[model samples]
Target: MVPVTRITIQDVAREAGVSVATVDRVLNRRAGVRSDTVKRVEAAADKLAYQPDRLAARLARARDYRFCFVLPTGTNTFMQSLHSEVEATAARLTAERIRISVRLVDVFDGLALAEELERLGEDFDGVAVVALDHPAVREAINGLADAGVKVVTLVSDAPGSKRVHYVGIDNTAAGRTAAMLLGRFVGPRKGKVGLIAGSLALRDHVERQFGFEQVMAREFPQLEVLPVREGRDDFEKVETVTAALLAETPDLVGIYNVGAGNRGIVAALEATERSGEVIFLAHDLTPFTRKHLVRGTIDAIVNQDPGHQARSAARVLLSACEDTPIVPDQERIRIDVFLRDNIP
Candidate 1:
């Protein structure tokens, strides 16, 4: 187990190569500090896992804070797990004087998400979302921020927006990790690799695909990546597209699903008599994926812990609402990789 250390202003100053006074100025949200210096201070604070000593500092004063979480409504196990975490964490957060509510929208409807964000108004102090990257959605997020709403993007991000923070893993790095595993597993076998996703409209999916392609081109140039199949996170669509791809590319030796709907992919894979011939990689660990892993059908699973994400998002939003600085290390979510031998 990692030991927890309480970070102080001095620690942050030393980490940032600055003085305690400079750290104080930045922490106090004071003026006259250069933007670069402020960033360095903030980065150091995060790296040091600095949280205000609530027991000793007067900043611990708390009041009722209203917050909302916007998630997609779907049969996807990952989304369900995320929602459950939000619900489960709510009671604990309520004890801290933070009231939480969850709102579900159409799985891929950006317009619906925009309307939800716009409708929130001043009724809620902060909002966290499993974002869908769209112009209207970005506009809605910015509009809320303009109205003094603390916005935090969860799982996915709305780039070019003034959202207070993004609470998720670096998708590009996750993709690169997936590619590295896939390349090594495929060995010297030169064959086409199938890529499937919910939608490129989602920044996470696009970034993952981009990273996968970049690594593949650089390290596994011999392996060809087939045209991406957009399954829209629907089991029927994913299954159909995956089956069709298998039919078209007899030389397909690997597949990477960057989004949900792993069940569909698994069904299609099971229909074939290839055994371990095709290597499968996907995001998220659920009952369905776990079963595939135990059977040795799916070669590897790349997952994000929704429970940690939900809790982190809440902490960040609460801090934003209370004018408290966040511990960057605490808010950083990790990507978990699993193999058949390491299913736990």
Candidate 2:
């Protein structure tokens, strides 16, 4: 048996310069205390080396805790997959006394996402956000963090902020992997390859484009990668852009899609009667993309499993609440490559 230190609420109250009731409110996270007072109480507790018995507090409080998830409302297959996976995990977490509320906002509209993040301040204990690299969104995340809300960035991340943690694969590495696959698939073909990205405004897309260009320039000098065309993650837009590229560059022997737009790419290739003739590489393993992979519409797919992303995000949030250490390796997501030979 280990020795324990006995500390009482009155002791904490005296040290914190507040009443016993204020200490109670801070410990239990009850209403009526100002944020500054709460911070003082927390600081006092830490100074005194105070640690609350979490199990006892949980049993006594028995208050339902809520987690908010904010994501983009887009038809892009990757976004849809992320939304579905989060919903599934939220449902499972409900059984463990956690309530998850999901909110969807227009991805293209940065103001809408920022507004949504701001609105979550009063309603949730923690938040999981798929963020864009915008100042308004970053400010909103900082506001939430200042309010003692644990923020976890999913898929896309906001760096240099008070966000508790992030749960996603290294997107730059994923991009490099995609480049490697495409370069190998091209196999010494000396021609300009077209690149399609969702939106350069997004950090993930920008990072991917950077990595792709870096690898292509370093390893395959003969393979000139064309300027990236923004598809906006829309099927019709992707098709239109791809068609224009095909028309302009007749020797476009290879293509790489660093974002969701596989459907449009497939349609464009088929309509142009060059589906199998062009070596195409894309991201994500949606049902349609999988089928296209087998049929040779897409030569390869760089997949990041949505299931893994959701689980990792949840585990990180839970660990934050419990004040526990995260297993980095377990949470380190993988960049999976899918080809015709390995469809699963």
Candidate 3:
């Protein structure tokens, strides 16, 4: 086991090049410390991740640590489950002197997401966001970190940001796995494969598609991956897209839904009476998808547990506040592949 290094006021004093008395005064908000010295002490404390003694001779203490979750607003079952997980996690952690609030935003809009993060500011000690791969979002995340608010990218991530941690599976690997599954399922057949996504702006979806195409180009040269369609995770939109694809491309033998709107895909296939004709694969293992998997509508599902992500994000925020060491293995989210025979 790795050792846990406990941070103390002496360590902060040494890092700040000051005496223990100065560190104490800075922490307690005493009037004797100079402004520059106080800033140095605070910076050292933050760098060392110093956790103050909140329960020192106090009967009850206010919840001074606040965390926020910024989730995408949509009807995707997986996103809905993630939102519920955060709410349940918040309810369970009420007595721990921590407050968690969730905000819904349009994750596909880079400007809107950037504005939301900019508004968060110092109101939240930590923020967990399902970020888009946008320059504006990255800048906003950096601004939050500069203001002493820890940021964690959840589910989807923003590249080149100052996020303290990421709480999700390896999306690239998941996408490559999806391609392998589809290629093998359509073994030795030469046909086109269709792809559907909520939005290419999402880092997770982009990475997934990249990995899928990489694998297909390298290993499965026999199959051709067609241009992807953005359905925005809406059932009706996905249905229309799928129906159009079926009508336009008769050689489509496989499909991989990298995002949500599973019901829409099913509706399109069933309406066209092509239910068992194509190799259909998707992400997320919910009640609706599980049923389809059992009924042979969906060949396989590459899934990530939303419960694991929600708990890990919350625990990571709490650890940042408490200056505790994190177990990387415990916090690692697994990429699960589920089939009809292995639904459990």
Best candidate per TM-score, number? Answer: 3
Which lDDT tens digits does candidate 3 get at residues 95-206? 6667899999999899999999999986999999999999999999999999989899999987699998999999999999999999999998899999999999998999
Report the C-alpha lDDT of model 1 over 1-344, residue by residue, as the tens digit. 99977788899999999999999899889998999999999999888888766534433555577899999887778989999999999988766667899999973888988999999967898999878888889999999999999999999998788899999989999999999999999999999999999988889999999999999999999999988999988888999999998889999999999999988888888898654899999899898899888898888999999999999998898788768779998889999999988877
TM-score to native of every candidate shown: 0.83, 0.83, 0.84
CA lDDT for candidate 1 = 0.89
Residue 150 local lDDT, model 2: 86
Better of 1 and 3 by lDDT: 3
Identify the superior model by TM-score, candidate 1 or candidate 3.
3
Model 2 TM-score (2 dp): 0.83
Who is ahead in lDDT, 2 or 3?
A: 3
Full candidate order by lDDT, most accurate first: 3, 1, 2
Q: Which stretches of candidate 2 lie over 4 Å from their true place?
A: 1-60
Query: Candidate 2 on 44-134: residue-level lDDT in tens?
Result: 9988877666545545656756788887776798888888888899888766667777899875567888899999998888898888888
Question: Best candidate, lDDT-wise?
Answer: 3
lDDT-best of 1 and 2: 1
